[model samples]
Target chain A: MNDYRITTYEPRHRGAVVEFQQMLWQGGAAGNSAYLDWKFGANPYLDDRYVTLAWQESELVGMLGVFGSCWEVDGHGRVMLPCLADTVVAPAHRGGPLFGRMLEWLVERLRADEVPWLLDFGDQPAGPAMLMSGWTAVGPWPVAVAEREVLGSGEGEWSAREAVRGSRSGATITPVATSLPEMPALAAETRSRGSVRVVRDEEYFRWRSRNPLARYFHLVAEEQGTVGYLIAHRTAVDTDDGPTPTTIVECEALDDDVWRDLVEAAVATLPGKVVTMWVRDLAPAREQSLASLGLSPTRPSGRLSQDIHLPKLVMRSTGVVDDAGPLATLTSPDVWDMRGVSGRGWR
Target chain B: MSGSHDVQDVARTVLDCLRNKLFLDGVTADTHLIESGLIDSVGFIRMFVVLEEEFGIEVTARDLSLERFQNVGSISRFVIEKLAEGGGSDKPAEAVRA
Candidate 1:
């Protein structure tokens, strides 16, 4: 612990950046410079404010990403906390102190800016680490996703095969059964929306555009060369099929059947089964492009972070302390008594 | 009969306006608007302001949550329901208002 000092890549340490990312990802599949390019490219939207690296003398021991800003949220309201992610500690340095040290440093940085909250997806093992560092888990967004592509034919082995194919690198992306009668209209509508498209280098595009843990496919519609639409590869349907390969539709500004085209494109690319996307509550139209598909009234689930003492935001469910059990007895006769750690999605 | 539907409408309108004005996406019934990664605590207060601006609804700190407005369906339901109930409660609309 005494041996390490934290640093950032603001000045652009190409070699160090590559090294840090290599260490952070830690696998041949770590997806190097191409990955960094994507992460940086996404900075405009992701806000990519904090990417602090921990160095023990000359060795990069860990890194943390802190993205904080204000954004309008659909269902909840205006959100202004920093999103914390990409926390990776070198396996050799995984003792109790490093995580806390990184967070303390982060808290200092955020506090300096007067930012209120911090949010993240936690690895269960890191629970105690955050608690020791002063992060109380208020709750988690209720939804999560996974990625896969189907191929070969209508809803059959081919579809499943395609899902596998779509996930692998260099695999051809084919649209699976997106040829719906409504596709033309869907594509037109997606095109009409005119959302700024997300552009990334291929590897970075695939990795940055996906759910970090899930690695699902993220497709967006592009106009000319600028991107304008996006499609998440996770689809939620009436049934909970096992290990389902889903593409969720996160954003799109096109007018044409954006849903139909992306879905169709997926169906075609996969070369099998019905390619589908998971959307929260009820919706989509496509044909233009997946990523360019319009946003539904539905909000994708994820947690928000905030300074505990904000004027209006108060903790009623009791996650402030490190208690795993529900602090208060719930009186909801209708809902089940859900109790767990503070970050439990049901809290 | 009227309570649930009214809350749902206001919730939908709020969600729609946020997406339109603020560039938010992936909203749904079970989506925890407040807790979701979308907003921070301060952002939460601004949401109330937006609601007021867009729907003419006055929300307070106490009027927040599932017990009152659980989902978008319930949120809209709660807003309209509570509004219909005539805003006479002493409790604040915490979820919607700061």
Candidate 2:
């Protein structure tokens, strides 16, 4: 008999989500409150694509959510991960193979869907699972800050045509800071992998994009009110590198050439030499867009971490297939889904 | 021939910097930088920049470990002393990765 079983939630059971949260965080009100806000608050952006819970002989062993999101680069944007904001293992079930199993289960789900995401589960539980799977790793995209302001403060942002304005004459790009309302409809049009769930909509949009720690920006190109390519700025973070204005290109349809031009246009508004913006990998278009602008990605050896306390709360063992239909197969979308990833914020 | 910042003082400073800046909403100096919700791998590059800029030192991509930047306090202490030594980054590739 299977002593341990895992269940991946459809949509998200906020009640179940909260209960699991309370159980995992035994540190009382302060710790629990902080944990909840961090996972599901304006201050923190939680992805709802893959949320799961584990059980060991009727005990709620662990639960976690694999939050999928879209990121911006110079080119196209697609779904990726930002938070692995899941709590694993009840304190009583501390030392067992539950942790590895939970992680394996998550990986199998991700692999099945063929979706790529950044693990944000406090760096502890994720270390082992990533190692076991040997996934190709990327960044601690340096979080830097410019003399910044709160996001959505109605600031006068750099215009998209600021690209052409800063560059050669007759540049055809325009940067638009979209109203919070547009995210959902645009997100609904997004393409994604398998049966993965997304938490896109207006309310989440306003909350996720408007947080103090989060920074978002977008680029759009139009020839005659007919738009072509667009990109998103992920969350803004403060670091000793000063501060960085970051963007995750959530989705893009422009061919590589147009994407490259757009990147050149975008980089003009940045703090020169300081490297305030850290655009993550998105469309293949960004492959050269960043390079053309004299910008380069920092290279580093893989960073690793391991869970000390909540091992069982991490992830599950793989090969246990989901009972769903074709939607269950985990293959990434050919086109990036924007709202599903905070909508057009990144692309 | 020690400089203005002592080995321990360097540690303290690094800890202080992390707490003052990168600490997420619920994070503090005592919180483990890696194990906490403060950062991810891509975020580490920025961590490096912060260490260099604020501490007036250099942390090469080669000088990385979960131990070095494990906690706010540990990262500070390590960087301060490393700075006193000219901030030279000549650690062997093996040691940095390990």
Candidate 3:
């Protein structure tokens, strides 16, 4: 094992951290630096920046970050917990115990602070390792995709244009200039099912809209007040076919018909070739709405097969709380309201 | 119901996958795959796919433990146990030998 020094992130280490994330961010240091600041600096949940770094002498070799997130557990109170994100190791230092060591150090620190639980919205590539490290895998949450080609219209451009203008449901879908002030009310009114969900207040909406990594579009359905709303963001993803423009619906109205109309309006106006969102099983109405919009879920061969590349909610107890009361609720997939909880939809 | 021959076949298939898919050579049944960082997350998933296809076994969330995949020996033992539990095909191990 190499003798690598592990330490917490300090402001002086900002420049190196930004440079280290360039490969991961792909938008150069400037964009990554801004993103880092917005995520950790302006965050309302936690005060200190919780980033762990591994250094081989003076060179930064690996990094793991934890950002504060607020979750509202039904019947239970709200708690601010850390969500693991931005895990990266330099290419030259790949295949080593550096990542494990860094993770160990971070977990230890969180444990010392008496954090009850830790959450991770990691990709499939990191899934097995997280599972091995005692993190409970929640849902592999199937994602629904809407593609222009799948509509089977020879006049692809015309169909999408028509989708934007065709609102037969009598709901007026208008693109909002900024994050809706009534987002919290709208969310509260729509959410009837009891589960743990991110507290999507005005503060969260404001912070989420300020993501420097992607461009966001907010559309609201106003009958009297804000009846329903949809938040979608577009970002470039390097697929096998090269960098393709991908739009992800981060959050939407829970009402089926409203959701369908919001999605239809957004898809027609969004510039991306593909638009996707996480689909939970219990919401048959939401599923029907997506189907109505010509979106279909990508079928993996098996749940545990290698074809399973979707992100899952992984969690672990910090061991600070002896009671397994909260952990039981968290581990159950059915108890999670996972919309916009993924923190930056493209994770 | 699995015998020594079945275990050997499973081990061989695992070794072949380690070499072919992960580009990991010189691995023994007792060699450390996870702790030594010989196989990464991507490599682990690739090996997973191969084991599922070769053995016609379903690896579930409960099976995703470090102890089950720590090394070739452990993996072979797990596959054999799963096969005995009717988790995989009843076909002879020779048919799926990598």
Better of 1 and 2 by lDDT: 2
How do the residues A1-347 of candidate 1 rate in per-residue lDDT, one tens digit apiece? Answer: 55778766564554666666555443223354545544443444445455778888877777776543233322333334455555677787764456657777766666566554455533433442243234444332222222334332334333243322222122233322222223223333432211111122232233333322223333444334212233334321212233444334343333334334444444444332333333221233331133332322222111121112211111112133223322221112111111111111100
Q: Give the true-contact fraction for every prediction, in order.
A: 0.00, 0.00, 0.42
Model 2 segments more than 4 A misplaced: A1-83, A86-126, A129-154, A157-171, A179-207, A210-212, A226-245, A251-253, A271-286, A298-320, A323-347, B1-98
lDDT of 1: 0.41
Q: lDDT: which is higher, 2 or 3?
A: 3
Candidate 2 lDDT, A1-347, residue by residue in tens: 23788877543444445566655444345554444444444232444445667876655667765554434322223334444654566766544555656766777777676544434424353343343343322233322123323333224554432544323323366666663344355555544432343455565565555533334555655444323344445333333233334444343433455555555654544322243333333444454355556455442322221112111112222333343533223332322222233222321
Higher-scoring candidate on DockQ, 1 or 2? 2
Ranking by lDDT: 3, 2, 1
Model 2: lDDT of residue A321: 33
Cα lDDT tens digits for candidate 3, B1-98:
23443777888888887888668877777789986678887777777767767777767666888888999889989888877776764443221111
Candidate 2, residues B5-96, lDDT tens digits: the string is 66566665655556566554565667876555366543555566566666656664235556777776677667766776787444332212
Instruction: Name the best candidate (by TM-score).
Output: 3
**TM of chain B vs. native, candidate 2:** 0.67
Could you give me the TM-score of model 1 versus the true structure? 0.40
The Cα RMSD in angstroms, rounded to one decimal, for candidate 2 relative to the true structure is 13.2
